[model samples]
Target chain A: MIVTEKQQLKMLSSAEMQLLHEGSCSLLSRVGVKVTHAGIAALLLASGAQCKGDRIMLPQDMVKNALAQSARIIQFEAPDPAYSFTVNGPENQVKFGTGGQALYVVQRTSNGWVRKSAGTDDLKQIIVLCNQLKQVDFITRPVECDLPDEQKDVAKAAVFRRYCSKPINLANLVKLARLAEVLEIIGNRAHLSFIISLVSSPLVMDSSAGDKFVAIVQKDIPVAISSCPQGGSTAPFSEVGELLQLNAELLFGFVLANVVRPGAKVLYRGIPITANLYSDASPRWCQPDSIRRVALAAQLCRFYNLPCCGTAGVSDQAVPSAQGISEKVLSWVYEAACGGQYINSALGMLEQVMSVSYYQYVIDDIALGIVKEKFSKAQSLAISQLALSAALEVLGCFGIEPDEKMEAELSARIRHIENGLEPYNETYIEDQLAVIEKAVNKSSSTVFMKAARKGLREGYLYKGARLDASLDLAAVAERLESSEGLGT
Target chain B: MNKDELLEKLEHSVVMGHLDADDEGYDGSMEGTPGTLELLEQALEAGIEPQKLIESFRVAMEKVGNLFASEEYNLADMLASAECVGEAMEIIESKLQVGNSSNKGKFLIATVEGDLHDIGKNIVATMLKGAGYQVKDLGINVPAQAIMQEIREFKPDFVGLSALLTSTMIEMEHVVRLIKEDSFPDLKLFIGGAPTSQAFADKIGADHYCRDVMDAMNKLEQVSNVS
Candidate 1:
């Protein structure tokens, strides 16, 4: 049963794939990404990555050697082995990467923000949302940050007493690293993540030094890879060239990460889409072509058989709107289709990894479902062929010849209808709303919310890993207590 | 010295990061070199206008920002570049004040409340400020009211906001609404970072969704011209 569909589409030859892979490697080694970590350079040099001063030139052999030791796949287990990014939970298995969502606060009164002091209740709510989300397979975590903002200036040293007790970005880095360290600390916990940047785009040796908090975890969270690319203003005005050059640096980063961790779960976050045609106003993300190129980038990583990350669900919009959807949907499909193991970026994320929308989590979760759905296997072999045979025997293929029967059977045997991100394409969104005779005369969602709130208050049921001894939890508690007064 | 020669000198100064008393050589450590007034004057003397000289400096600074944004360079290098750029700009500022005024426009940008990751916001701001725009950088965790108050006080033509976390992005909707309600309705609202898009901008009624700094400036200039 030959469907003969897309047969002549000329699938990329293994040679072509190899070429792309080599190109990435060469780009990385020859141009090299920027380096912020001294440890990374030492490790790369130790592992035979040709280093000239600060910049490292890693040959393809190094990349292949490092990748050979990479863990092919991993499964995230719940409640305990929190270190793995996996798909081995009780119900949902969709793991989430860090989402770069835009637009954090909604305004309250004339000049006020509707902020709920991020606390236990808020943490619990996030957990609940993660659990309830059908799209989320496993939680991407060390989910901790955002303390309440106080109007009165609190003492800098009294950070622990004045504001809601929680770690902010760089502050949270150490706490999250500890969380990572404890969670099934796999790969190289001793080495720092390899960081490489572009020569042209290079600031200097050891230029960017953030994310060092993860250093305490002993797991080399490889970073400092130059997204050094010239879209229009800086480099050639070609998307493909931009991708190749960027991928080259990123691939070098991969080698660096691998050199340090030796096939560790390196995050291959792609940063493409520079300014368009000499003008900064026409951002490449706003263009459809840019989205497709990013998608191709996912496949590019796959061609190298390396774990991939970055640039999906990210949009060029200032807020959640029409332009956001088109960009995200296009790029997300590329990510899902290209088999990216880990990726993030919110539907309403904007301005190049700066912000994300609040509702985007829920909305993007649904969008994530579309990506997760691609991994879903639909097999008709599970359905009794005999049962279908009887129904087919009664009617037959209208006017099909005997030879055509085999083709039809083959088509039916393995038919894949590409449901391109139509969330709930088959069924309308619904809940178990009907009342039964045994049910009570009334029902209340608020009551359920109340019970959940109580459990959160007790602290026995749920409490996320706390960090930052420098902050106060009192204000957060008070704010959580009066959250109902906050959200409209 | 003319514009080309001045640009070359300024480029060297920016790269080298200092100047001698007679403008002979770099004065500080190899990496710790900071920009100075002499460099700007030399750049101006080369006939490169103050604006172009600053643009050259910005070009150099953006490379640093790009490295930071992509995780190529670490935070220290990034902060150092910021320091270098700041010093360089002081020279640029003084030189401009001596003769002309360079204000691209009153551009207001901030990292919205309930979010604290400043790398992206800071990077965008650096590029904007580099381009000679009067960037009123409202530091991280800024409330909408604070933004409006600044917008009122500053009378900025553009309001820029950034967020880093997903849960916090929900807060941006209010910021947008506040600006609309309290500030100028016709205000050219531009936003960016990860999780923002053209569609999201339309959804939230933002004037523009910028991906990169070049895009931000280009769109800013187009949507609402700065006189």
Candidate 2:
């Protein structure tokens, strides 16, 4: 899983990263994050964060101290012991895991693709299926249990304990009160971890997530303080603006994590995806624009030398197809090449985290294997070459031949990711910050969407030609049929 | 300039999504000039009729709507124009006589309990206000009790509920049930959010399921036309 320096994709130079870090610090100290939890606010205030109305502003020194005090190497222990791994901040190792809070389970039927409501049984089946998938290094709770709010945490933990042997990431705690019972059911805190979106977009902290984060960190459990800001919606439409806000939000989590428990095992999870402003403002997960921003986020996380929990391969397509496979391959390659140590949502996700398909799981396993193989065999090759080659090979395996138009589209995508769309500078960052501040102050993302009017007219989002060849899903179907515990 | 010229400027400013003299507006260079607010105030000071200003707002918003539909403007441009009309309506309402104002039907909007998402709700509220409706924005994480209380007090003709999280969808259904159980039979319930669909609306007994801001506007317009 280690990516060599030659194979690494460096989207931002050190100077650019420094500017982004400085901008993040400025945002934290200036705009600040709204902390609704009084106790957390008090804790932050006591820890050198100034109180500005409802927001708690972290100074540069405070943020730097928190960064220094955070754990550099986070050990993700698995129940099987042999599957355990450690994510070192300075290492180039990348691990892929299944992750999502998908509401539906998609399956290919004789009639068509059927999407049914995902329940606790689907959680068990997914865990069992992923346990056998060699490419799945760890297992994240992909779907929430169909239980009452109070019972969900414990019920989901029990299901993972009984079915999964890999490192278990109960993505989020539904109820903080049930944490004790959930941990007791799992029986090993070492084998367990959690993901908390402690801060909402535009620097607003979710009170419930804050409470859960405090409890989990206090328990000495490894957690990924995640922040996903959809550009043109909750964040600025520009990549620079979105990254500044995203970095600020994640840094706020790190400061709070250190405040809660010094050296708290927290990974930097920043997914700076864009909103589909051309239509419904829903999040575009694995589109080319999102792929670029997410890869940039990974690179930035590496710049901070933080344990990176990257997100990729969450396909935007509703069903598994050639376009989905191409998107997943490119996303996985770029994210891994950019130093994502512990990648999540790397398999089975579809429809922008709305659904997970069983067939898609096997397909992702194969496609990811192809990607990792390409990365490992790569020598003196740029990330763009690795991505394009891997994507073409993966698509060819899926019975998709990239026509000239599609090849040109893929080449353009690689070029775009290789060369960023926006300039990372002081003036640009300040303007982006102003847009975010406007959105936050007004409590509406219309400022961002309005700001994006020009960009949309200029094709800010990649409108590439899709690979329309019908996917030969025979291998996927065979794998799904032969896979154990899928109830197929 | 003259009153007619001032009115034309005000309308133009709204269409350009300018708020005040400080606003950069659509093209980001219109700052430090007479924007919608400044122009409206000047027109009013120059003895322009409030009804005439209202007519200008309607015309400007219609143009903005067309721009948005044609992809020349986005949600932000539309919202900016709507905000101009919304703020102008507040000023113009005071100038007009009681019950003779150009106000449309009252609309109440809120994100359901346990959900802190407000972008969708805020956009809908601003757009409704721009469309000449008297909108009451209850904001995010509003509990069912608070929403019901607001419904009773506001007596809105339409109640729009929003919840981005599936967990809060239940709360949305609960809010809808509470509203339905009340005596306000003429109140139309509209539900929206990522998880909401026509099926969910039907199951929860909501009168309509808005897919997005445009969908909400279209449904509201249909009801307005029917009434």
Candidate 3:
């Protein structure tokens, strides 16, 4: 899937993006990221990063140099050569893939929707089901194996090799000691990729993930350095603040990857979602605020011309419904239009990445097909207009009729996505940095949550009507009934 | 100001979630004002009894808890208030007699081995501290041996284990086994994190499973009352 030149949506102005880039550089130089791995810290220190105790502070030149040295285009090879794809930084190409470390499998039974713990069997069935889905360009491990830690990597890799013929993304390497065996089981590194959250939120380098990332990047394997900072908790609640922090985290990974091995194939995956402060403080993955921030992350990745691994379509709704589908349609459209090169977690995720549904996979395939069709015919159409039209059409197909209120709510969402919520100035960025620094120094998000009080009062999060009508899953059921190896 | 007024200001500052003179308080506009710490120091200098100050903390925190329960205050507000109380307790702890400590109980918490995530653990720790518990956070990725050693030395009244990943959840079970294998009587074990549940806690022999910080506090309070 490719987002054409005409369909590309630029949410942030060029000046705003430049300011964000400079803000990231300033944050890297001033506050710095806490690197627990001594060897990796030494590598970064030798490469012009200043050492401030445990933190490794990279200079602006070091960040720019690392960005220059990183590979701009990455080739994702599949077991079947025809399914392989290339993600070029300068192009508007987009690829959708299944993703999540979902814990439960949601199935609609005669009684009601029941969620069962997902295991190795669910992993195999998901892979088989995704293999037949037309829109899933790649397969990121959606569920973890029930095996012990030592055997998990190898077991998951073996399952992928057996059931999935598309590009395989064995999401994370659980144990570094088993990496060799897992690679051997796959037999070809070209068909395999991985995602590592190398840096935790608020600029803390995860020591375990750091080790795995070093080992994987040393082998020249394609990996995405992901950083998911939930605003109002792990990150600043403001949009500008969260993006600045998220970008700095991912840029830290880029610098580390280049330091370990220059030109290491790494994708920039930044998911700056928000926490629902109104309730349980749980992450709102597909909400309007999150959709806007995630789309802006994709846009910023394109601004750096880095290979982007975007996250979209992870619904906050626990069960499959009209609301979930509506959220997914809007998320996929905005993410792709805003320049996500290789989007992961784009299908079958539900319950805010806690669970996945087999029926939702078919529904997403059909919904994504509708989105792509809208994009193909979207010549000279504004992305917001196209998104609204596509979402309405998809919902109508699933027995949903959008009333005027729903349309008004969606328009408000689009307007929010199109506008900047906070000022992108040096003073504002400094304040945001101070908030992040306070949280990091205290080793908690208390400062962030405190700062979020104002944002919440001012309605930083979107309050819109939910399209909560039940989704007609008749077509989805029919498609799943015909699909092979689902074990239904 | 008089002792009564000073104590009143201290309580108000805490309810406002103000920490020090630099804190912005709950609404981001109270940075220049004297905050909880300043007001607490003032009350102490004014010859207010440490026990009275402890009573004020309890009152202010109860108000914060009510606000949080009613959804008038979010986690950040509650956490900020908790942080204020936590910092204030550090100051007030020195003035009290040996047996007159304000701590409700001692808590030892950690994110189990192989888990680097700590937001949940940090929240629980801060809340426990704010709720008048003497908390020793062992931090993330702490091995069972270190936890056991800490148990021997610290002798906490409660132990809370946290793990975000399922892999580390297994480590939680392992840590629980090691703790149970030891002869630590009257030390209740609690498990929490995104992956943990009541079923998991029951299977792993933990005394309780905390869904969140409030649940941890409420459950600990309930157990305290019962015992």
Candidate 4:
């Protein structure tokens, strides 16, 4: 619990937290999210939500009520506490958590489809960066891969096997079911909060997607509910209005996830951005105001007595530029403020969360360090009076009017700063960068890669674990046709 | 070419990157004629060069990049765009050869073995080309010795190496050091990928890091000025 001055200014109060919660709920119920999966819609209809065809709309009060009931602090420590992190509650400081950092990150990726490249490291950098930052909650897609590249989507999903303590928000559906099937791959050791996705098309869940959704239920997987919508795209353009649409859609996803995997956990997820013209190619969620607003919106998930997952930190810059810094910070800060339980994307991600950069990842870690210093809460004084006295004497008494003595103290303090003093140290960035290298080189890769490879070799998690090693040929052919035949 | 058409082809080329399409281009193929350079020149001669052509290629491509914001285009589009840009670059490249080459310095680019993704490598190449450097791309999944061999033969001012995988990013470091330890002691090596960092660069002793195109340009300019 290291607190800093900047953190003190940014801390949210209980009442403020509740207002945010209510506002988010009001938005969720009034606007309502689309339910893409029909089966999910049925589940919500069976619940208390209002049914409109496939769409199950939630009421404003219902959203507010749900927000109030949702769990605020999720003690995320595993039964083995050693590799655990407490999914922090609001008021307890934190940054944001991202879904993942993929191999094929982009400066701009909006459409659901992206030409998959085998083993893009840009995504990996995001995972490491998010992992390096204290504010970020999850580290995902920690590796590269081979083949037609789309299965690499699963690689983003696959890294979860290595990070049980930090539950991963993998691409929902089949991957979720596969994760459940391979629970032993992770040895039931890690806590995985599965992402059960719903439609942005109101409230209908896809039948096939539902089958996969139900697989999580069958496995009794802990699921998080999300109905992400982009204005004029997956959702209407208005922020609150869009939230309402998603609320209904998400509620359906939640009910389906829980009906199958009863007691499966849920975390509300959303995007606070505008859309580009006719194409769904890009979503503008990085505006500072939008990020802040989304932070407030994520509190509605808390209304459900569940943890919240709010995304931020995707930049359009392929490298570490002012734009990258701005998008990354807005995203991270919003998630932290929203009191999200799982945060990712503090590193190695760019564009609309499409590409990754190793160097940029290093730069992101540097930014995270700077931001952490900016937001860390100041702890109570536990040091001795002697230390306090010496610390104070170094730069005190120079507050208002700088006299000769004050000038002398300031000069000495400046020298100390130049020489790497406490509070204001020398290029901690260099140290930070060094540590990043070590983390990427010495630590993160060697141990986990071996595990991931071994995990898949020994057999990976799949939706219908009827276990078909014989299907290798079909998979290969399917891969070849998608890659070569499509004429990309 | 109109903005839309230019963007479409440029996006295609970037997605379809080529490292060894070597030609001392006395031709106009790099102008993206959808075929080889000989055909590309014919396309360019139909009147493709303009400040608008250059700047708009970047702008339209970026605007096409708008798909990234609300989750429209996705990572696949990005890869496609990157490859497409690579193709368009080929076309632009031949034209560059025809003009007073921007190549203030010569750079060599490659990917380490078992690393097939070329997104980062293409970016560096394009940026270097944009900044007026004569870049020789070695393509994806290259071996360390190949780089050393390339250096021995070509004697480039800077060597840019990329590895898309963390497992392979490690190999980049080893090769960077190997270039110094075994051969090309004077080679200015730059390493990038998702896993390698500035700290990694310093620890492994890579002379410089091209954090981005602009940074690489500035770094190259500075390096040349010093020499």
Q: Give a tens-digit lDDT track for model 3, residues A1-488.
A: 77888788888889989999999998999989999788889888888899888988999998998899999989999998889999998999899999999989999899989999999999999999988999999999999998877888989999998888899999999989999999999998999899999888889998889999999999999999999999988899999999999999999999999989999899999999998877657789999899999999999999999999999999998888888988998899999999898999999999998899998899999999999988887777889899899988898889889888878877887777777667888889888888888888887765677789889878888878877787788888999989898884
Ranking by TM-score: 3, 2, 1, 4
Instruction: Give the Å shift of residue B170 in candidate 3.
Output: 1.1
Arrange candidates by DockQ, highest first: which order? Answer: 3, 2, 1, 4
Error of 4 at B125 (Å): 37
Model 2, A1-488: lDDT tens per residue? 88998887788899999999999999999989998899999999988889878978899999999999999999999999989999999999999999999999998889989989999999999999999999999999999999988889989999998989899999998889999999899998899999999998879999999999999999999999999999988899999899999999999999999998999999999999998876668888998899999999999999989999999999999999888888898899889988899999999999999999998999999999999888888766777888888888888888887787877878888876777778888999999988888888887767787778666656668877777889888998888778876784
Decoy 3 TM-score against native: 0.97
- Regions of candidate 2 where Cα sits further than 4 Å from its true position: B1-6, B94-102
Per-residue lDDT over A1-488 for candidate 4, one digit per residue giving the tens place of the 0 to 100 score? 23333322222345544443444344345434445456666665665667554345665544444444444454443323554665443444443445442445333224522433425343433443444444345554433444333354455444445333344544443333444334554555245445544442333344555666666556654445555544433333333334444555665455445445444545566554544322212445454334544554565554444666666676655443444454565455445544554654556566555456444454455455554543443233221221223222322211222246534443332232112111112242223223222322321211111112111222111111110111112332333234321222
Query: What does DockQ give for each predicted structure?
Result: 0.05, 0.51, 0.59, 0.02
Give Cα distance to truth, residue A110, candidate 2, Å.
1.6
Docking outcome class, model 1: incorrect
lDDT of 1 at A157: 14
lDDT of 1 by residue, A349-433 (tens): 4545544333444545555554333334222222223222322321221222224444353223212111111121111111101
Better of 1 and 4 by DockQ: 1
- Supply the TM-score for candidate 1: 0.46
